[model samples]
Target chain A: MKRIFKIYTPFINAGMQETATYRVNWVFYILGSVLGCFVSYFIWHAVFLSGSGETMNGFSLPQMIVYIFLIFLTSTMIGSDAAWAVGEEVRDGSIAMRLIKPVSYNATFLFQELGNKLLTEMFLVVPLIAGLEIVRTVIVGRVEFSVVNLLIYLCSCVLAYLINFFFNICFGFLAFVIKYLWGANMMKNCIVGFLSGAIIPLSFLPETLGRIFMLLPFASLNYTPVMIYMGVYQGTELLYYIGLQVFWALFFFGLSKLLWVVSVRRLSVQGG
Target chain B: MKHIRRLFRIHRIFVVQELKRMMEYKGDFIVGVIGFLMVQCSNLLFLWIIFNNIPNLLGWSLNEVVFIYGFSLIPKGIDHLFFDNLWAIGHFTVRKGDFDKYLTRPVNTLVHVLFEKLQIDALGELIMGIALVCVSLPQLQIEWSVFKVLLGIAAVFFATFIFTGIKIITASVAFWKKRSGNIIYMVYMFNDFAKYPVTIYNEVIKNLITYIIPFAFTAYFPALYLLTGENPLYNVGMTVLMSLALMSLGVFVWHRGIRAYESAGS
Candidate 1:
């Protein structure tokens, strides 16, 4: 284990260094997120103000604002473009370089992604969320924060990242067959964006559709963690949500492993 | 006149070459078209869901909002089809020093770079836009006239100029920054605001979109005029003016950027 750790440490460090070099890009990325948050916030605010209701779709005005903010935060925390990167490597056959290396490709990719996400969460997401929390507190008063909930939320976030990573890897493997994965990537983004409640709250969806989406792995990515943070699920239900997240993460990881094996074998047979 | 004709001939040849290259990967083209169609479909679904919950957003009905959304796509699609290569400037050409090739070309560098590639994927957006407009036409109940048709064509033409102008200006930042893809992306993303009625937003956002970014000229104002047949002269006039101003500004920036260009070493 120590030897394996030593092997991956360089990759993690290199990943962090590479991300730091793109400071301007990161600034614009955060700006885009802030702008997106504002768009959603203002849309919801307009809807609530114009409509004759204290609550629409089971959320009060303040709750809705906080919910949108949390949605953006959760999305930033869990989202991964590893699939696109992996897909590009696979398409160009540079993935062969990694294959010849002593380290496992999956582990290397995971560590690199971890390095990138850690820096982003530290420098971009954390500060943004902190500022947003202050704004939320000012507008909506204190949020209910408990040590227990925080712990569970953190666990769920980890599981959510794993699920997102594996889910993306599955799509990345499509590069084995498709000459261009841009369309597939966009399709995956649209489906996942909708199903994961990144675009709208799951509660706002129809009952049948919402329940179906809950059963899918995408929900575990964003909705589950946000719901836990909001204290919407507690006790046995909370445990169930966490269990589901774990299950999806493991499920996707196994599936991605299988797909990767098959794809590598196909590539080899094709003289790739 | 001779120079203009030569430019058109060169543009046509470049477009043909681009089309040939795109056709070489027919499966990729099909997938790209389907992918974009799915994106538009999902957006429509979101709008449908919103309208289902609330019959109207602000004072605009579902059809009106959809009309505006659909109308916005035409100019965007046209710009994408013709000038999408501007994205390569911010993304790679300048950053990787490939921009040196454009400088070596004898023809106008901006035109040469722009006409170098045609994005066929935008055909999806164009088709979808036309489909949406047709679907909403009867519901809008606008009186059809030759003058109205001409006006609509003019509005879309000017809107295309606006989209191209913004892209060129944003991409020109590559001269100084090495890579300005993120800034370009952020600016393009702001166009999402133009898909809906400006009244849905607060005063500050409204002003920002209207005067600062002038995205309101791209879709909302023109759609409002077409649907209500009110303020046709003012709205369309402003769109034309904005388009010309933005295009000139884009040219000015391109000239400035070219002067500042220090080619990345091979």
Candidate 2:
């Protein structure tokens, strides 16, 4: 166990070094975020214009803009289609070398991915976010964010990453059984987009669907946290959301471990 | 005449081969069709929600909006069906060095790349589009004048040219840099914005869409004619001419870009 930890710590440290560098594929990251944020600004701006109401569902224009901004920002920051990456690696025989290492392949990936994500968020997402905030203030003409709410939002964003990672790993590990995991990843993307309220806000959903959405683990990654930040929920609701996130993180993480073990066994049987 | 026939034969063969390739996974083809329909249904639901809130958007009625969506979908569907490969052409050609094979071909490399794949599932979107048009025509309460019907056909064809033109231009960007995927995404973003009435957007963005990007011609101008039961502006002739001209310009730009291509791998 100690040997495994030692091997992975250095592997993750190397990954962290690569992650800390702001050179490779960073342009695509910025371009995607900029395009997403810019296009969304135009879309919601038009939607909001169709009414004379002061707000849509208790969110003022600025608040709504913030919601959209954070939704895109956090989705880009927190979202990891790990299954897609892992499935590709396994299918291409890269997993062979990974499995031979002293540490568990999944453990190494978990730490490396977290490190890469942290690097991306700090170097790219954070600066872009700061610029977006400035732009939003200029365009919407006001800015209001509570420090406590911001902190909570940030923590939930991190938890969202864990949930996403676990789901990805579970689906990714299926590559051991299925030769092609593109379809599975596609389905995962579709489900997560809808369930997590990343497509459209849960607040925008019908009351019954919104209630159902709240019950789903996917909501903890996005909708619940954003709403809480927007002051849509108070103490008990906030606590419930955070607690639900904890439950989901643990549940999915455990499931990923089980899936990993089964997948490894299947791979060994196949001489893979 | 003989040359034209030979070209047509090659096009047909290309399409047939693409169809055969797609047939390898018949289950996927079916699921893909269903998935596309679900996506279209979601877009239609957004329209329904909008109409439920208000009877019409801007001055256009529900049927007019539906007509816009319908016509837009036709070009979009055909774009995906025939030129679906355009989205990936940049990446495949430049990054992966797939352009070497195209350069070796006797035919126009651009045409070869553009028509390499036909996403058969987009046929579902096209059928839905035609259905929406038929449904919308009756609800719009318009006379079936000969000129109006002809204009509608022209509009749909014009839309195809414009959309294919944009895809070609965006794909041609791969000649310069490998990161042209975002360029394609930017085009799609504008295409999404163009689905609704132009009047819904603010003045500056509206102008940009119309004059600079020419996305307005894809659905907005055509839908306006259908909605008003007359040409919305005296510039119908000008708009049609402009659409064709822009398409030609796109082709010209693609020709220019292709000449500068440095095939990455081979």
Per-prediction TM-score, chain B alone: 0.98, 0.92
Model 1, range A1-272, lDDT digits (tens) per residue?
99989999988898889888997898886786577777777767767766777888788877777678777877787888878988888777788889999788888989987888778777765676567667767876676445576567778989999999998888888888887888778778888888988888888889998999999989999999988877789899998988999899999999998998788887742245
lDDT of each: 0.85, 0.73
Q: Which tens-of-lDDT digit does each residue in B1-266 have in candidate 2?
A: 99878777888999888778777877667766766676667667656754554444556677887888887788778777888887787546577876778889988877777767788778778888888888988767666678877877777777777778777887788887764766766666677667777777778878887887777787878777866766545325545765688678878988888788776754
Give a tens-digit lDDT track for model 1, residues B1-266: 99999999999999889889988999988888888888899888877876767757777788988899999999989998889999999888899988888888889999998889989888889899889988998898897788878888899999999889988999999999998888888888778888888888888989988888888899999888889788888889899999999999999999899999898876
Q: What's model 2's TM-score? A: 0.87
lDDT by residue (A1-272, candidate 2, tens digit) is 78766666766677678865544445554564565555556545655666567776565667767777777777777777578778888767777887776666667777787766666777765675577678767976777546677678888878878887887788788777765465445555666667787666676778898889888888987887787667777789888888899898898999998887777766643255
Displacement of the residue A136 alpha carbon in candidate 2, Å: 5.7
Stretch of 10 with least lDDT, candidate 2 chain B: B230-239
Off by over 4 Å in 2: A1-52, A127-143, A173-187, A265-272, B54-56, B232-239
Per-candidate iRMS values, in order, are 1.6, 3.5
